[model samples]
Target: MTKNETDERRAAMALLAAATARELDSAWTAWPERPAVEDLRKAACGLVMVRGRIGGDGAPFNLGEATVTRAAVRLSTGHIGHAYLLGRAPERARLAAIFDALWQDVSARPRVDTELLAPVRARLAAEAAKAVAEAAATRVEFFTVTRGDNQEAAS
Candidate 1:
Protein backbone atom coordinates (compact mmCIF):
# COMPACT_ATOMS: atom_id res chain seq x y z
CA MET A 1 0.00 0.00 0.00
CA THR A 2 1.17 3.47 -0.82
CA LYS A 3 1.22 6.46 1.53
CA ASN A 4 -1.76 7.89 -0.32
CA GLU A 5 -3.82 4.76 0.26
CA THR A 6 -2.96 4.75 3.93
CA ASP A 7 -3.84 8.42 4.24
CA GLU A 8 -7.19 7.85 2.55
CA ARG A 9 -8.05 5.00 4.91
CA ARG A 10 -7.00 7.08 7.87
CA ALA A 11 -9.16 9.96 6.74
CA ALA A 12 -12.17 7.71 6.29
CA MET A 13 -11.78 6.07 9.68
CA ALA A 14 -11.30 9.39 11.41
CA LEU A 15 -14.45 10.73 9.79
CA LEU A 16 -16.48 7.73 10.82
CA ALA A 17 -15.15 7.68 14.37
CA ALA A 18 -15.65 11.38 14.84
CA ALA A 19 -19.17 11.16 13.50
CA THR A 20 -20.04 8.34 15.88
CA ALA A 21 -18.63 10.16 18.85
CA ARG A 22 -20.52 13.31 17.98
CA GLU A 23 -23.78 11.36 17.72
CA LEU A 24 -23.25 9.75 21.12
CA ASP A 25 -22.49 13.08 22.67
CA SER A 26 -25.58 14.58 21.09
CA ALA A 27 -27.78 11.80 22.41
CA TRP A 28 -26.40 12.24 25.90
CA THR A 29 -26.92 15.96 25.78
CA ALA A 30 -30.40 15.85 24.32
CA TRP A 31 -32.36 13.20 26.15
CA PRO A 32 -36.08 13.02 25.34
CA GLU A 33 -38.23 12.82 28.45
CA ARG A 34 -38.07 16.39 29.68
CA PRO A 35 -40.85 18.08 31.59
CA ALA A 36 -42.46 21.25 30.39
CA VAL A 37 -42.60 23.80 33.17
CA GLU A 38 -43.92 27.35 32.99
CA ASP A 39 -40.72 29.03 34.13
CA LEU A 40 -37.86 26.66 33.42
CA ARG A 41 -37.76 24.13 30.62
CA LYS A 42 -34.41 22.48 30.50
CA ALA A 43 -32.54 20.65 27.75
CA ALA A 44 -33.48 17.02 27.45
CA CYS A 45 -32.82 15.25 30.74
CA GLY A 46 -32.98 11.54 29.94
CA LEU A 47 -33.55 9.29 26.96
CA VAL A 48 -35.44 6.03 26.71
CA MET A 49 -34.85 3.58 23.90
CA VAL A 50 -35.82 0.04 23.05
CA ARG A 51 -32.81 -2.23 23.05
CA GLY A 52 -32.77 -5.87 21.97
CA ARG A 53 -30.79 -8.49 23.81
CA ILE A 54 -28.41 -10.66 21.84
CA GLY A 55 -26.87 -13.34 24.12
CA GLY A 56 -27.61 -15.21 27.37
CA ASP A 57 -24.46 -14.75 29.41
CA GLY A 58 -26.86 -13.07 31.76
CA ALA A 59 -27.04 -10.96 28.67
CA PRO A 60 -30.07 -9.12 27.41
CA PHE A 61 -32.28 -11.32 25.24
CA ASN A 62 -34.43 -9.57 22.72
CA LEU A 63 -37.78 -11.30 22.92
CA GLY A 64 -38.76 -9.48 19.73
CA GLU A 65 -41.32 -7.65 21.86
CA ALA A 66 -39.42 -6.56 24.94
CA THR A 67 -37.30 -3.46 25.44
CA VAL A 68 -35.30 -1.70 28.12
CA THR A 69 -34.95 1.91 29.17
CA ARG A 70 -31.71 3.77 29.72
CA ALA A 71 -31.02 7.22 31.05
CA ALA A 72 -28.15 9.66 31.45
CA VAL A 73 -27.77 12.78 33.52
CA ARG A 74 -25.34 15.50 34.44
CA LEU A 75 -25.37 16.78 37.98
CA SER A 76 -25.59 20.44 38.84
CA THR A 77 -21.95 20.51 39.82
CA GLY A 78 -20.99 18.79 36.53
CA HIS A 79 -20.92 15.13 37.54
CA ILE A 80 -22.13 12.96 34.70
CA GLY A 81 -24.11 9.77 35.26
CA HIS A 82 -25.78 6.88 33.48
CA ALA A 83 -28.26 4.09 34.33
CA TYR A 84 -29.74 1.11 32.56
CA LEU A 85 -31.56 -1.44 34.66
CA LEU A 86 -33.81 -4.42 34.18
CA GLY A 87 -37.56 -4.12 33.59
CA ARG A 88 -37.76 -0.37 33.78
CA ALA A 89 -36.71 0.03 37.37
CA PRO A 90 -38.46 3.02 38.86
CA GLU A 91 -35.59 3.55 41.26
CA ARG A 92 -33.28 3.96 38.34
CA ALA A 93 -35.75 6.34 36.79
CA ARG A 94 -35.87 8.30 40.01
CA LEU A 95 -32.10 8.39 40.12
CA ALA A 96 -32.06 9.76 36.60
CA ALA A 97 -34.80 12.20 37.55
CA ILE A 98 -32.80 13.47 40.46
CA PHE A 99 -29.80 14.01 38.27
CA ASP A 100 -31.97 15.69 35.69
CA ALA A 101 -33.22 18.14 38.26
CA LEU A 102 -29.70 18.83 39.33
CA TRP A 103 -28.63 19.23 35.74
CA GLN A 104 -31.37 21.71 35.01
CA ASP A 105 -30.31 23.90 37.85
CA VAL A 106 -28.99 27.06 36.20
CA SER A 107 -25.55 26.59 37.66
CA ALA A 108 -24.92 23.11 36.26
CA ARG A 109 -24.89 23.53 32.50
CA PRO A 110 -21.67 25.42 32.00
CA ARG A 111 -19.49 23.13 34.03
CA VAL A 112 -20.95 19.96 32.61
CA ASP A 113 -20.59 21.21 29.05
CA THR A 114 -17.10 22.47 29.63
CA GLU A 115 -15.65 19.79 31.87
CA LEU A 116 -17.41 16.56 30.93
CA LEU A 117 -18.37 17.08 27.31
CA ALA A 118 -15.13 18.76 26.42
CA PRO A 119 -12.94 16.02 27.85
CA VAL A 120 -14.94 13.25 26.25
CA ARG A 121 -14.62 14.98 22.90
CA ALA A 122 -10.91 15.49 23.40
CA ARG A 123 -10.41 11.84 24.23
CA LEU A 124 -12.33 10.81 21.15
CA ALA A 125 -10.15 13.03 19.01
CA ALA A 126 -7.00 11.58 20.50
CA GLU A 127 -8.18 8.04 19.93
CA ALA A 128 -9.01 8.79 16.29
CA ALA A 129 -5.57 10.30 15.78
CA LYS A 130 -3.89 7.30 17.34
CA ALA A 131 -5.87 4.91 15.18
CA VAL A 132 -4.89 6.78 12.03
CA ALA A 133 -1.25 6.85 13.07
CA GLU A 134 -1.24 3.14 13.78
CA ALA A 135 -2.80 2.31 10.44
CA ALA A 136 -0.36 4.54 8.63
CA ALA A 137 2.53 2.87 10.44
CA THR A 138 1.56 -0.49 8.97
CA ARG A 139 1.51 0.72 5.36
CA VAL A 140 3.78 -1.18 2.94
CA GLU A 141 5.25 -0.15 -0.38
CA PHE A 142 5.88 -2.52 -3.29
CA PHE A 143 8.28 -1.83 -6.14
CA THR A 144 9.71 -3.71 -9.17
CA VAL A 145 13.15 -3.08 -10.68
CA THR A 146 12.82 -3.01 -14.50
CA ARG A 147 15.65 -3.34 -17.04
CA GLY A 148 17.09 -0.05 -18.32
CA ASP A 149 16.66 0.81 -22.02
CA ASN A 150 20.49 0.48 -22.43
CA GLN A 151 20.85 -3.14 -21.24
CA GLU A 152 24.60 -2.89 -20.63
CA ALA A 153 25.54 -3.28 -16.97
CA ALA A 154 27.88 -0.68 -15.41
CA SER A 155 31.30 -2.00 -14.42
Candidate 2:
Protein backbone atom coordinates (compact mmCIF):
# COMPACT_ATOMS: atom_id res chain seq x y z
CA MET A 1 0.00 0.00 0.00
CA THR A 2 1.04 3.56 -0.62
CA LYS A 3 1.86 5.90 2.24
CA ASN A 4 -1.42 7.78 1.90
CA GLU A 5 -3.42 4.59 1.91
CA THR A 6 -1.59 3.32 4.98
CA ASP A 7 -2.24 6.61 6.76
CA GLU A 8 -5.93 6.50 5.86
CA ARG A 9 -6.24 2.94 7.10
CA ARG A 10 -4.57 3.87 10.35
CA ALA A 11 -6.98 6.75 10.77
CA ALA A 12 -9.96 4.48 10.15
CA MET A 13 -8.72 2.00 12.74
CA ALA A 14 -8.35 4.81 15.22
CA LEU A 15 -11.95 5.84 14.58
CA LEU A 16 -13.11 2.27 15.06
CA ALA A 17 -11.35 2.16 18.41
CA ALA A 18 -12.96 5.39 19.53
CA ALA A 19 -16.35 3.68 19.55
CA THR A 20 -17.84 2.97 22.95
CA ALA A 21 -18.62 -0.58 24.03
CA ARG A 22 -22.34 0.09 23.63
CA GLU A 23 -21.82 1.21 20.07
CA LEU A 24 -19.57 -1.74 19.30
CA ASP A 25 -22.08 -4.16 20.80
CA SER A 26 -24.84 -2.71 18.68
CA ALA A 27 -22.72 -2.96 15.55
CA TRP A 28 -21.47 -6.42 16.39
CA THR A 29 -25.02 -7.69 16.35
CA ALA A 30 -25.17 -6.82 12.68
CA TRP A 31 -22.02 -8.80 11.94
CA PRO A 32 -22.52 -12.35 10.69
CA GLU A 33 -20.13 -13.82 13.27
CA ARG A 34 -17.29 -12.84 15.55
CA PRO A 35 -13.76 -13.71 14.61
CA ALA A 36 -11.81 -15.82 17.06
CA VAL A 37 -9.27 -13.86 19.04
CA GLU A 38 -6.59 -14.94 21.52
CA ASP A 39 -5.48 -12.56 24.19
CA LEU A 40 -1.72 -12.07 24.10
CA ARG A 41 -1.87 -9.59 26.91
CA LYS A 42 -5.00 -9.14 28.94
CA ALA A 43 -6.17 -5.60 29.48
CA ALA A 44 -4.31 -3.76 32.22
CA CYS A 45 -4.59 -0.27 33.67
CA GLY A 46 -1.57 2.04 33.97
CA LEU A 47 -0.61 5.68 34.22
CA VAL A 48 0.75 7.72 31.31
CA MET A 49 2.02 11.23 31.50
CA VAL A 50 0.05 13.75 29.50
CA ARG A 51 2.08 16.46 27.86
CA GLY A 52 1.29 19.84 26.33
CA ARG A 53 3.03 22.78 24.74
CA ILE A 54 2.47 26.41 25.52
CA GLY A 55 0.47 28.12 22.74
CA GLY A 56 0.79 24.84 20.84
CA ASP A 57 4.30 25.72 19.64
CA GLY A 58 6.36 26.52 22.68
CA ALA A 59 8.34 24.17 24.92
CA PRO A 60 6.49 21.01 25.91
CA PHE A 61 5.61 20.32 29.53
CA ASN A 62 4.02 17.51 31.43
CA LEU A 63 0.39 18.49 31.91
CA GLY A 64 -0.58 15.65 34.20
CA GLU A 65 -0.93 11.91 34.37
CA ALA A 66 -3.91 9.99 33.06
CA THR A 67 -5.12 6.49 33.72
CA VAL A 68 -5.18 4.28 30.63
CA THR A 69 -6.10 0.70 29.90
CA ARG A 70 -4.22 -1.29 27.29
CA ALA A 71 -4.51 -4.72 25.71
CA ALA A 72 -2.98 -6.92 23.09
CA VAL A 73 -4.45 -9.79 21.15
CA ARG A 74 -3.81 -12.04 18.21
CA LEU A 75 -6.23 -13.22 15.60
CA SER A 76 -6.53 -16.96 15.00
CA THR A 77 -4.73 -16.35 11.73
CA GLY A 78 -1.73 -14.69 13.41
CA HIS A 79 -2.41 -10.99 13.07
CA ILE A 80 -1.50 -8.96 16.15
CA GLY A 81 -3.54 -6.10 17.54
CA HIS A 82 -3.12 -3.64 20.37
CA ALA A 83 -5.11 -0.84 21.93
CA TYR A 84 -4.67 1.95 24.43
CA LEU A 85 -7.65 3.79 25.85
CA LEU A 86 -8.08 6.51 28.42
CA GLY A 87 -9.67 5.66 31.80
CA ARG A 88 -9.96 2.14 33.22
CA ALA A 89 -12.25 0.29 30.84
CA PRO A 90 -10.45 -3.00 30.27
CA GLU A 91 -13.24 -4.61 28.29
CA ARG A 92 -13.40 -1.68 25.94
CA ALA A 93 -9.67 -1.92 25.42
CA ARG A 94 -9.89 -5.63 24.59
CA LEU A 95 -12.77 -5.14 22.20
CA ALA A 96 -10.96 -2.27 20.52
CA ALA A 97 -7.84 -4.38 20.04
CA ILE A 98 -9.91 -7.17 18.54
CA PHE A 99 -11.45 -4.75 16.12
CA ASP A 100 -8.02 -3.44 15.28
CA ALA A 101 -6.72 -6.90 14.43
CA LEU A 102 -9.81 -7.71 12.41
CA TRP A 103 -9.46 -4.47 10.51
CA GLN A 104 -5.98 -5.45 9.35
CA ASP A 105 -7.28 -8.54 7.60
CA VAL A 106 -8.24 -7.81 3.99
CA SER A 107 -11.22 -10.15 4.10
CA ALA A 108 -12.49 -8.68 7.35
CA ARG A 109 -11.74 -5.03 6.59
CA PRO A 110 -14.88 -4.31 4.58
CA ARG A 111 -17.27 -5.79 7.12
CA VAL A 112 -15.55 -4.12 10.04
CA ASP A 113 -15.44 -0.78 8.22
CA THR A 114 -19.08 -0.84 7.24
CA GLU A 115 -20.66 -2.35 10.32
CA LEU A 116 -18.43 -0.96 13.04
CA LEU A 117 -16.16 1.90 12.02
CA ALA A 118 -18.40 3.90 9.72
CA PRO A 119 -21.21 4.45 12.20
CA VAL A 120 -18.77 5.42 14.92
CA ARG A 121 -17.05 7.88 12.60
CA ALA A 122 -20.38 9.44 11.69
CA ARG A 123 -21.43 9.75 15.32
CA LEU A 124 -18.13 11.31 16.31
CA ALA A 125 -18.34 13.80 13.47
CA ALA A 126 -21.87 14.74 14.42
CA GLU A 127 -20.88 15.27 18.05
CA ALA A 128 -17.92 17.41 17.01
CA ALA A 129 -20.14 19.52 14.76
CA LYS A 130 -22.63 20.04 17.57
CA ALA A 131 -19.89 21.13 19.92
CA VAL A 132 -18.56 23.59 17.37
CA ALA A 133 -22.04 25.00 16.80
CA GLU A 134 -22.66 25.40 20.52
CA ALA A 135 -19.32 27.14 21.00
CA ALA A 136 -20.04 29.41 18.04
CA ALA A 137 -23.36 30.40 19.52
CA THR A 138 -21.58 31.85 22.53
CA ARG A 139 -18.82 33.54 20.50
CA VAL A 140 -18.09 37.18 21.23
CA GLU A 141 -16.89 39.62 18.56
CA PHE A 142 -14.92 42.76 19.31
CA PHE A 143 -14.39 45.84 17.19
CA THR A 144 -12.84 49.26 17.46
CA VAL A 145 -14.64 52.53 16.76
CA THR A 146 -12.61 55.63 15.88
CA ARG A 147 -13.25 58.66 18.13
CA GLY A 148 -13.46 62.20 16.65
CA ASP A 149 -9.94 63.11 17.85
CA ASN A 150 -8.41 60.01 16.28
CA GLN A 151 -10.21 60.68 13.02
CA GLU A 152 -8.86 64.25 12.97
CA ALA A 153 -5.29 62.99 13.61
CA ALA A 154 -5.57 60.56 10.69
CA SER A 155 -6.80 63.38 8.42
Candidate 3:
Protein backbone atom coordinates (compact mmCIF):
# COMPACT_ATOMS: atom_id res chain seq x y z
CA MET A 1 0.00 0.00 0.00
CA THR A 2 1.00 3.58 -0.51
CA LYS A 3 2.20 5.58 2.49
CA ASN A 4 -1.08 7.48 2.82
CA GLU A 5 -3.17 4.32 2.56
CA THR A 6 -1.00 2.59 5.15
CA ASP A 7 -1.38 5.54 7.49
CA GLU A 8 -5.16 5.56 6.99
CA ARG A 9 -5.38 1.86 7.74
CA ARG A 10 -3.33 2.33 10.91
CA ALA A 11 -5.71 5.06 12.01
CA ALA A 12 -8.68 2.80 11.40
CA MET A 13 -7.09 -0.03 13.33
CA ALA A 14 -6.38 2.28 16.25
CA LEU A 15 -10.01 3.39 16.34
CA LEU A 16 -11.25 -0.17 16.04
CA ALA A 17 -9.08 -1.31 18.93
CA ALA A 18 -10.26 1.53 21.17
CA ALA A 19 -13.91 0.93 20.38
CA THR A 20 -13.60 -2.80 21.06
CA ALA A 21 -12.10 -2.18 24.48
CA ARG A 22 -15.06 -0.06 25.54
CA GLU A 23 -17.58 -2.67 24.45
CA LEU A 24 -15.66 -5.42 26.18
CA ASP A 25 -15.52 -3.43 29.39
CA SER A 26 -19.24 -2.64 29.25
CA ALA A 27 -20.15 -6.24 28.50
CA TRP A 28 -18.12 -7.46 31.45
CA THR A 29 -19.83 -4.93 33.70
CA ALA A 30 -23.40 -5.63 32.57
CA TRP A 31 -23.19 -9.41 32.08
CA PRO A 32 -21.24 -11.48 34.53
CA GLU A 33 -21.53 -14.64 32.44
CA ARG A 34 -20.01 -13.21 29.30
CA PRO A 35 -16.48 -14.44 28.82
CA ALA A 36 -13.92 -11.68 28.52
CA VAL A 37 -11.84 -12.03 25.36
CA GLU A 38 -8.74 -12.48 27.45
CA ASP A 39 -10.52 -15.13 29.50
CA LEU A 40 -10.75 -17.32 26.41
CA ARG A 41 -8.14 -20.07 26.40
CA LYS A 42 -5.37 -19.17 23.99
CA ALA A 43 -1.74 -19.84 23.17
CA ALA A 44 0.90 -17.29 22.31
CA CYS A 45 4.29 -17.41 20.62
CA GLY A 46 6.80 -14.87 19.45
CA LEU A 47 7.97 -13.82 16.00
CA VAL A 48 11.68 -13.09 16.39
CA MET A 49 14.41 -11.44 14.40
CA VAL A 50 17.41 -13.67 13.70
CA ARG A 51 20.05 -11.09 12.92
CA GLY A 52 22.48 -9.11 15.06
CA ARG A 53 23.20 -5.36 15.18
CA ILE A 54 25.24 -3.29 12.71
CA GLY A 55 28.27 -0.95 12.97
CA GLY A 56 27.85 2.33 14.87
CA ASP A 57 29.93 5.12 16.38
CA GLY A 58 30.15 3.51 19.81
CA ALA A 59 31.40 0.04 20.78
CA PRO A 60 29.82 -2.64 18.59
CA PHE A 61 26.50 -3.75 20.02
CA ASN A 62 24.30 -6.66 19.16
CA LEU A 63 20.92 -5.70 17.77
CA GLY A 64 19.92 -8.99 19.31
CA GLU A 65 16.18 -9.52 18.86
CA ALA A 66 12.63 -8.24 18.83
CA THR A 67 9.45 -10.30 18.99
CA VAL A 68 5.91 -10.14 17.73
CA THR A 69 3.22 -11.93 19.68
CA ARG A 70 1.09 -14.28 17.65
CA ALA A 71 -2.14 -16.11 18.38
CA ALA A 72 -4.47 -18.43 16.53
CA VAL A 73 -8.27 -18.50 16.48
CA ARG A 74 -10.31 -21.32 15.02
CA LEU A 75 -13.70 -20.26 13.78
CA SER A 76 -16.82 -22.40 13.59
CA THR A 77 -16.58 -22.32 9.79
CA GLY A 78 -13.27 -24.19 10.04
CA HIS A 79 -11.15 -21.20 9.10
CA ILE A 80 -8.18 -20.36 11.29
CA GLY A 81 -7.38 -16.73 11.83
CA HIS A 82 -3.86 -15.81 12.85
CA ALA A 83 -2.79 -12.50 14.38
CA TYR A 84 0.64 -11.08 15.00
CA LEU A 85 1.06 -8.10 17.31
CA LEU A 86 4.12 -5.88 17.67
CA GLY A 87 4.23 -6.84 21.33
CA ARG A 88 2.59 -9.25 23.74
CA ALA A 89 -1.19 -9.51 24.27
CA PRO A 90 -1.89 -12.56 22.18
CA GLU A 91 -5.54 -12.95 23.08
CA ARG A 92 -6.46 -9.51 21.82
CA ALA A 93 -4.40 -10.11 18.71
CA ARG A 94 -6.22 -13.35 18.04
CA LEU A 95 -9.61 -11.75 18.42
CA ALA A 96 -8.53 -8.94 16.11
CA ALA A 97 -7.27 -11.39 13.52
CA ILE A 98 -10.53 -13.27 13.58
CA PHE A 99 -12.41 -10.05 13.10
CA ASP A 100 -10.10 -9.10 10.23
CA ALA A 101 -10.80 -12.38 8.50
CA LEU A 102 -14.50 -11.98 9.06
CA TRP A 103 -14.31 -8.45 7.72
CA GLN A 104 -13.44 -10.03 4.39
CA ASP A 105 -16.88 -11.53 4.28
CA VAL A 106 -19.20 -9.21 2.37
CA SER A 107 -21.99 -9.71 4.88
CA ALA A 108 -19.85 -9.86 8.00
CA ARG A 109 -18.12 -6.49 8.19
CA PRO A 110 -20.96 -4.78 10.01
CA ARG A 111 -21.21 -7.56 12.57
CA VAL A 112 -17.47 -7.59 13.05
CA ASP A 113 -17.50 -3.86 13.66
CA THR A 114 -20.27 -4.21 16.20
CA GLU A 115 -18.84 -7.25 17.93
CA LEU A 116 -15.10 -6.55 17.72
CA LEU A 117 -14.21 -3.06 16.55
CA ALA A 118 -16.23 -1.24 19.16
CA PRO A 119 -14.48 -2.72 22.17
CA VAL A 120 -10.98 -2.59 20.78
CA ARG A 121 -11.41 1.00 19.74
CA ALA A 122 -12.13 2.01 23.29
CA ARG A 123 -8.97 0.37 24.61
CA LEU A 124 -6.86 1.92 21.90
CA ALA A 125 -8.35 5.34 22.49
CA ALA A 126 -7.42 5.16 26.16
CA GLU A 127 -3.91 4.05 25.26
CA ALA A 128 -3.54 6.83 22.71
CA ALA A 129 -4.79 9.45 25.12
CA LYS A 130 -2.31 8.31 27.71
CA ALA A 131 0.50 8.49 25.20
CA VAL A 132 -0.50 11.96 24.09
CA ALA A 133 -0.63 13.20 27.66
CA GLU A 134 2.78 11.74 28.41
CA ALA A 135 4.26 13.24 25.25
CA ALA A 136 2.71 16.62 25.91
CA ALA A 137 4.56 16.80 29.19
CA THR A 138 7.85 16.83 27.32
CA ARG A 139 6.93 19.08 24.40
CA VAL A 140 9.52 21.61 23.19
CA GLU A 141 8.92 24.58 20.95
CA PHE A 142 11.59 25.95 18.56
CA PHE A 143 11.74 29.00 16.28
CA THR A 144 14.14 30.52 13.77
CA VAL A 145 14.49 34.02 12.36
CA THR A 146 15.96 34.53 8.90
CA ARG A 147 18.14 37.48 7.76
CA GLY A 148 15.44 38.32 5.21
CA ASP A 149 12.93 38.94 8.03
CA ASN A 150 14.43 42.35 8.80
CA GLN A 151 14.37 43.38 5.09
CA GLU A 152 10.78 42.28 4.67
CA ALA A 153 9.64 43.94 7.90
CA ALA A 154 11.30 47.24 6.96
CA SER A 155 8.94 47.44 3.91
Top model number, lDDT: 2
Q: Candidate 3 on 61-88: residue-level lDDT in tens?
A: 5565666666555555444444555666
Name the regions of candidate 3 deviating beyond 4 angstroms: 1-44, 50-62, 72-74, 78-80, 87-90, 140-155
TM-score of 1: 0.33
Scored by Cα lDDT, where does model 1 land?
0.45
Task: Please list the residue runs of candidate 1 whose C-alpha ends up more than 4 Å from where it truly belongs after superposition.
Answer: 1-69, 72-107, 147-155
lDDT score, residue 152, model 3?
70
Sorted by TM-score (best first), the order is: 2, 3, 1
Estimate, for each residue in 79-100, the C-alpha lDDT of model 2 and write its tens digit.
Answer: 8878887889888888888888
- For model 2, the stretches where C-alpha displacement exceeds 4 angstroms are 142-155
lDDT of 2 at 70: 92
CA-lDDT, candidates in order: 0.45, 0.83, 0.53
Model 3 score (lDDT): 0.53
By lDDT rank, best first, the candidates go 2, 3, 1
Q: Kindly give the number of clashing pairs for every candidate.
A: 2, 0, 20
Judged by TM-score relative to the true structure, which candidate is superior, 1 or 3? 3
User: 1-155, model 1: which lDDT tens digit per residue?
Assistant: 48985574344323222333344445346644533322122222344444555664555643543333445555434444443433434443334333334344446545434534455567777998999999999999887556677556522
Checking candidate 1 for backbone clashes, the offending pairs are 53-60, 53-62
Candidate 2 local accuracy as lDDT? 0.83
